[model samples]
Target: MIIKRKVNKEVYMYSIGIDIGTTNCKLCVFELLSLKLIDSYSFATPKINSKYGYDFDIEALYSQLEQGLIQTINSLSYAEKVKNIVIASVGESGVLINQEGEVVGPCITWYDTRTQKNLADINQKFSDEELYSITGIPIHSNYSLTKILWIRENCNINLQQVKWLCIAEYIAYKLTNQKRAECSLASRTLAYDLKNHCWSEKIQSAFAINHLFADFTQSGKNIEVLTSTISTKLNCNQPIFVAIGGHDHMCGSIAAELKPGEILNSTGTTEGLLLLLEKVNFNKSFLTSQLSFGKYVKDDLYTLYASLPSAGYSIEWFKRTFSVTDENFDLLIESLLNKLDDINYIKNSLNIFIPHLRGSGPPKRNIDSKGLWYGLGENSTLADILLSIFQGLCFELKNTLITIEQLTVTHHPIIKVIGAAAKNPLWLQLKADILGREILSCNIKEAVCKGGVMLAGYENHYLDKNAHIQFDNPIARYIPNPKMTEYYHQIFADYYQPFFEFKTSLEFKLKKDN
Candidate 1:
């Protein structure tokens, strides 16, 4: 993406990017012209264990955000000026606040299954077909609407009296006193009317959630300028403009310049494959595929998105749980690829690993499913298991991409990968071999934050859109190894495919009997 360069704009005019992730929250300051990183700070997201699952400590979250902002701004030279600040975050979690902007209830996370009962109640009222048709989200508790309903009922809060703001929106409100929902994030809520591009009247009225959210706006829409209190709090002399940055993946897609027949594989704690399209597809084929459809960062465009909730989290969980060291698991399996021609050896050595650690996504979206590994021998080493985890995540991604191809009826040759996936060469190669698609490692460090910066730059006439979309070069490329790709095709069809079906059934029976 092109950097902002105009004068009236000095060398020190900068933009701030606030990315509130599930695991790590970051604040980055970038030079609007060079797009050089000036300063950055990071902290863990504050989450507390609730009776049902986990709830975000809002006060703690804001405190950490405030600290990062102050540290980034104060470190600048006196000549520097701040232009715009934008926020991006997870789409599924938010906080409820009273009229005075004080948090009123617990902010439960999207993965918390405590809202299953609330979802079932809604399912009883509307058919799954109708629900998905209206919201473009499958019937799942991971969306904001289910969690909002859970808080409203469990906390005994009056839905009509208070309002909801997603985590990013909350941060913006604290700075600028504007309570606006980004269109992309608002599209994730099950209560949003996708066709009409507004809040759903039928669903909101049925659930008594009228007047629960403020007005929705496009990403990078200039809502308001920073308040005096915030300016003084951060010790900043110049004014700061706050704009909505929308969902993390949609924001990252801006840097990728994602176009038709191209897919963006955003890997972080979670992983999602996002395909940009001129129109939305909610047909029955997509309904069964269970891929989510939502408003893109550009208000007129749309996205077909599929997620693996435990992509990177699975690696972290295995390393932490098993106390595995930072050994090179990738090298341990390189010798195995050489034996692809030996059918007998390949069959005996290959093990099945399924990463459903944070529920299952697409085709059969279920929150009850857990991860599994099969064919583990008594002598299985930690390194061997780690290799399996990496291979498992690649296979899981392939499974979703197959459904995406069948539904969209489009085949993409080169898939652009950003975020954590770009940093890991082994993961990218494995994904290329498994999917038989070339993987381009678009390694712009903190690309999502860069997206926020770019949006703010363009909104303020500091950037050129045509020039910014020219970041079409990949830092690295991973082409599929033909021998390895051929071997994977057989295993994916003969073993992985059949095992996935069996495990889905097993999970269903386990949930039903319980």
Candidate 2:
């Protein structure tokens, strides 16, 4: 698919990026000249139910994408200029199986936890350390591999003739009729060996699951061209270009221009912090994989990531649990700030919250871990609870930072904050204090989408010789408060020690019970 690059004064070439998220799907079009987002649209993901315990609705997915693209195009000032489309989707290991290669089971959501038993058994068979060393991710029921194992054990479906594809690959198949998975998404699967950049024969043999993996593509490589049908649907005379951008996290980091000592924190439904590194730092204790997706950057770069299963979800939970209306919730949070203007409520508050309402993520991927409220008494009020939740999230971020720091002897790298949560001044300030470092918040809220746009722009020759995206928004930096930092260090140490000890004991108990 070739597009004629016509240089115009007022008319700039645009690239489109579609992010298929867990709850919603987003579409954004960017002007290649300035790398500025020109237009954007989003739609809620359609839910599905299946006969085999799992539920996924591909028809709804198709409908949403169609509607989102149409709406986005209609809203654009120059829709005809959109020359490329890139997709970054959530990762999963389950295969869509049928005689005709149709998606049979629902897209196994990364949040789904029905495979607890499968995960425990996998851990017992292959020690947690070894599994992490191979997969780069800890053994968790949420992963697609365990979900597949669960379905095979319980369902009556044949594993033969099935094709395993990640969420991104599945979408690409639907759009372009191709069955290709990218290295970024493939690496997330427990079966993929990070070091070799392919499915691990050793891990596959250990699991004894049928081989149904898809071919892998490196990030930033163009995989397939859009079908004529999709081009007609979008009302574009030009061909739709599809490229292999990796996991949303990796792509977002690339969009943010992540470098060594520079971290990218994406705050959405799940908040994650990724640190770019030059070389792999293997940890035998944790058994982490040394594999990473190749960077789009000219120089070699790797990433160390820490994800929290619940970040914005925790706030959502709080709102629903307390029955706080959206308007009232904002007002209440604003009121808390006004009431505690003189106090460092997040750092100095006596209360501590463990935000594991769903489950703990990373370092301790404990599914059984429940949310807890510590140091709470009669004096604890709604304001205190609110502040505690923020502190809890900050503490989690601090824990991940400390782990990355220990793994790599780096210190005080400027952390780049992005996503919806980055808009929260109090939250960003709390994170700065907890980490004892400066936080740089990018002007762009949709960094992942912009990252895709950056890739598409580079592919289309929209970027300058230096490969930089020209934007008007200046980077905002927040410095840590030394007083609050000192207090947070003490609170973090006391609160985290007990949590780790409790987590260790709980893990032992779960193993013994199993």
Candidate 3:
């Protein structure tokens, strides 16, 4: 049992949160007393060797963080008020660090598709069921172990001289000079034993990756104090605690006020639907469908994550390709929403789209599946086409949600949405109507970053032991329109399902013929 401490209102404290994403990195400063965001900074993630594969310059990311950290710290009136710093990052991407604590190579991006060849070799070594049982992750190329093996096979790096560190761990190492792998990020490696909460000896021996991983540490565990060098660089007097925050989605879910029966829909460049479970439910059918189960930040909970790799990216693609004027994205979104008011017009029109521009994510891991726009007539307008994308994406999420409900024997009629897409009222309404559920907008612009702050506060004992740091009351709630919900039910049953089944059949036939 844990003892609760009484609050001290006289003391003032602050914490810093850094979230490293696929396309951007965000730094947030939170005032611990009020739990409010004081200031923030962000920069686009720099891509390296774009012509070959998607990779990030780890050094560039560190430089941005260093500058951002100093700037944010200077903005605060009292430097001593800053208490701790926590780092959160996207999974599956990590850097190889040498004995001298130097990055040996670029951090491979999870979006990179260069490890397909390594997948077959890995599959031959361990069956999918065995891999999923051990790691609680699907046997996919978009995992750190596969990418690391690919680099070893292709690059001139000496494995004996370096150890693998996830992006969050790399950042923590830079701040405190401690080589530690946070449990949440470590689970993404597809080399961790979820049951034992350590690196899987079977996977390590099979891949010869023994002694190439950092010490596995629990999330929210304070590993090191900020070094004097970092404190001097930031012009700070306080000794900051450096703690580990988990994967961005896990953090986002925490920020979105995750509950036992609720799901968090985090929509940014990509869209992820996360559900929290108190215990691990290792279902064979679920694992076979490629759904991932990993450790959540809370010790008692695990996360089931399903994603659409190109949800928002595909929307941006459509806007870039079709917009005639230099209209702002928000303006385009509002215009599209206004046009969606005419329900009968949309129903009469036959324009339809499939939201798989970057391959289908889970339940159907088909790399060859391409996005399709069908039944577009001469009467179809740009708004109609845009609405189709929204419909298709919602349908895709509904399918994923259904699978999750079946596998877990739980029902989440409402999903809390966060990030950029949560700011769009129309998108929220559409999700509610199509999914036939309520859409609660949490309105957290940088939930991933906020989650990092919350974790830091929890670790430092600034937050209440029983109270969750996430927003409890949603800023807005969207209820489904009965008519729209009914229509979408029919459309999903008659149109989306048939088309998806046909696409799967065609893809399989082509592969067999080849």
Q: List the candidates' TM-scores in order.
A: 0.94, 0.89, 0.94
Backbone steric clashes in candidate 3, count: 0
| Reference-based lDDT, each prediction | 0.82, 0.70, 0.82
State the lDDT of candidate 3 residue by residue for 173-272, as single tens digits: 9999999988788888999998888899999999888889988776877788889999999887768888889798888877776877788999888898
lDDT of 2 by residue, 1-514 (tens): 1233343524677777878776678888877767777778887766554544344455677678877887777676667767777788766634565658676655666776677878767876788777766666666677778877776677655666677777667777767877777766766677777666678888777766546777766565567777888878777776666765667877777677776677688877888877766655446644442222222222446556667878988998888888889888777678665543344454445677778877776666666677777777777777778888988898887877776666666776588888766677778777787788899887574777888667655655656537665444677787887887887788778776587568658766986898
Which ranges in model 2 have alpha carbons more than 4 Å from their true place? Answer: 1-11, 48-56, 74-77, 93-99, 120-125, 205-211, 288-300, 338-341, 344-349, 377-379, 503-507
* Backbone Cα, N, C clashes tallied per candidate: 0, 1, 0
Candidate 3 structure, TM-score to reference:
0.94
Could you give me the TM-score of model 1 versus the true structure? 0.94
Q: How many backbone clashes does candidate 2 have?
A: 1
Q: What does each candidate score in C-alpha RMSD?
A: 3.4, 3.9, 4.0
